[model samples]
Target: MSDRFDPILLSELIASHKQKIADLGVVIRYNESFEELEDKLPIDSKAALTPHFATALNTYTSANAFWLGGFDEDDQLVALSAARLDDLGGQAMSEYLKRYWRRCYPAEDGDLAEASETQPRFWNEVRGRVAYYGDFHLKREGYQGRGLPKVFGPLAMLVGAQKWDADWYYTWVRERDWSMRYPLAYGFSRTYFPGLRWVKPPSSIEPDLAAGVNSRSDVLDWMETLSRPGEQALNK
Candidate 1:
């Protein structure tokens, strides 16, 4: 829980995180409340309002996307990140992101149509609360190595899980990108199901092949490092 963190330690961690990026000639701002972030996304983020990036913007039917932003010298929104806070404790979790896509895009693709039809089956294996770790975007190249992922990713997870009061955490990564995703989600187990995948590039992280956490301790343990180079399980 947020209470477990030492205020001074957390503040120091934040300052250090900012300094890492600032050293690369960038500025960062972390917003704890979704209200301030929901008001007019940055110019680079206008693509998100179009529904394709809604999940990245942290916009969900019954939830707000806890977000963080990085900007260039002129403050023009160079990098932005977010995580989804929604209930997958039951049918809610099943819909997770698919619902958002359907509501906004409305059966635009072959896979989405199939996913819409296959939604019920996907829910069968989903239960308990779930938080989605996603919506990370770097407007420009050469910035990822600036320690931004380490700085923003976990902080987004920390805030989003706290915001939604969720201990169940998960994220999507296409199988094609396994090398990158698996390392980030070390403590989560992959849950496979029928048609439980991204509708478009369903293979993006492999459908139903998503990762999840069962309790707060796991979330906390993982957050201790976010992702260690070769962590084999929830804990040593």
Candidate 2:
């Protein structure tokens, strides 16, 4: 999609979200190093770095991917998110995944053949310059019920769009996260069940997954709603 946003309005909305998080006693930093980010992730994190952002195996320059971390009063990393440009050009998302499933999520004796058969019908229609946001984590101790997702969701998409001019934003959501209705909280408008059907799934990761998607137009409209005067968008 074209960059149709008002720079001033975008800046204001981004600042507003950052301020909201700061009020919760978290400091945000735009990190350029994925290695540092991988190191900073909690050792016991169930949501470990996916192969999409694995620096050891993949090279992500500033133009393609970006990561950020939030720190508390003691400078401890408490929350984090990352986004990357998945340039599909004219290929369907389902086809792209089928071609790169092992590269994206490497596992021995894995089965990804079901993707071609069971993927949502919309996957064939979704293509071109997709911004994939993932690696969202929170420290659970004091972050829950604080409305951080509302802030992080929009802020991450806006930044990704600004950098990549992505047509669509998508991510793979865990089954539990979907059950909790976090997709709605994250400003995603559409969700598809059984986004990826693995026949021989790995025991290390959550087997079931759903897809969260938002068109650039949808995100722009959401920003417009949030930027309206007296809206109090993030709080809701």
Candidate 3:
């Protein structure tokens, strides 16, 4: 864990979030096995598992990445989220994405090269240690409207912050999910429209996305908020 924050307060904040979700019959645990974790993800007609966290495509270990699995009373995996450290010493995120867009979204092949040219203004400001978050999936059967995200999302980012001390927490989400306020529930401070675009994008993934962002200060403030009275547990 990073030493930038108070250890005592950090522990308390994490415990508080854990307890809040525990009431919903969910137990959260950290895992480093991306290969196994990927197998556990729900296989549905959504965007294919992101290559950013796929073990076959990229490298993510205990040293630089972490995945959180939320299981229920039956010990069945129901929610998933992961983050990885993108250390760009002095490079802009847009430039980095331009070069790796194919690696990150290999499923989209036709006109994939066009993705490199599309950049949101906010992308230029992202630099240094970045906690690139993705691979978030939550079953909708019994977990949709129970306020799982209120705690789960923040808890994921909190764990990411502890591990990376990242300058920013960033992700690209479907525009519909953004319209549904998923990013806000995930603790991102800002959301930029048309984050990533393509001229003839494949139908497998959304052609456009809303980029979610959360600065280090924003994360710290969230932890402080949870430490206060009446905010220890989120409402259902």
Candidate 4:
């Protein structure tokens, strides 16, 4: 739904990278001809639709989304990640934010339900100026230590930035991922705590952290190395 980022293009770029990843012994696929996968995505899960999931599905349904899957050499799904773009900073946007954010983390510093109180400042400062990336999930088994985040993170932001020309980008990541230093290397604050979670990360582990970036850097340039045929077509 965002005018700034080309979800379709990013999806294509990701899909084309599958062969390169395959060359490394792991085959990955990004969204290509997504509509054909409609029956494939929601047919297996039966978990209770939590507010968070519901909202995420809504965002996923929007045009600003990218889905990636890492398949075994046999073509079985081993790892996957999905991300969506969200904008904040207006009366309508504030309400949409509260609808889902309150369920997870809604405070300036781990407060857990003050989004309304902070809506003005959030709206005033970041509304329309910033873009948020959320609903990203990556499984651990088939893709460990393979530098997925380094590639995916910057690519997502690049598409987001290209679409909106927004001031910054943010995402919620578990504490462990935060401790790894990749996010900080990409330009997000390492110690900042914008929101505390209630049931996020499934309540059995550490809370998630909201990380963000304001501009491009060398870390983003690393994405250039990931270029493949899918992206080449975009340039022409």
- Each model's TM-score, in the order given? 0.60, 0.87, 0.87, 0.54
lDDT of 2 by residue, 1-236 (tens): 45487778778887898899899999988876798887776723534587767787778887788987788999888888889887899998877876666545534455432234456677887799888888887777888888777787767777776677678888889988888777767767778777776645544457688999888787777677778756544534
lDDT of 1 at 6: 41
The deviation in Å at residue 112 for candidate 4 is 10
For model 1, the superposed segments whose C-alpha errors exceed 4 Å read 1-16, 31-46, 49-63, 88-92, 95-101, 104-112, 116-128, 142-144, 182-215, 226-236
User: Which candidate achieves the best lDDT against the true structure?
Assistant: 3
User: Per the 3 Å backbone cut-off, how many clashing residue pairs does candidate 2 have?
Assistant: 0
Error of 1 at 141 (Å): 3.2
Q: What is the lDDT of residue 56 in candidate 2?
A: 70
Deviation from native of the Cα of residue 59 in model 2, angstroms: 0.8
lDDT of 4 by residue, 1-236 (tens): 33343456555655554444565575655662334334234322322222333444444554555555555677655444444556554534435555566565344455454334344333333344445554444445656677665444554455555545554455556666666665654335423444432332333224455444443332233244334537524532
Task: Decide which is better by lDDT, 1 or 4.
Answer: 1
**What do the candidate models score in CA lDDT, each in turn?**
0.51, 0.76, 0.77, 0.47
Q: What pairs collide in candidate 3? A: none
Name the weakest run of 10 consecutive residues (lDDT summed) in model 1: 186-195
Give the distance in Å from residue 133's predicted Cα in candidate 2 to where it truly belongs: 0.7
Q: What TM value does model 1 have?
A: 0.60
- Candidates 3 and 4: which is better by lDDT? 3
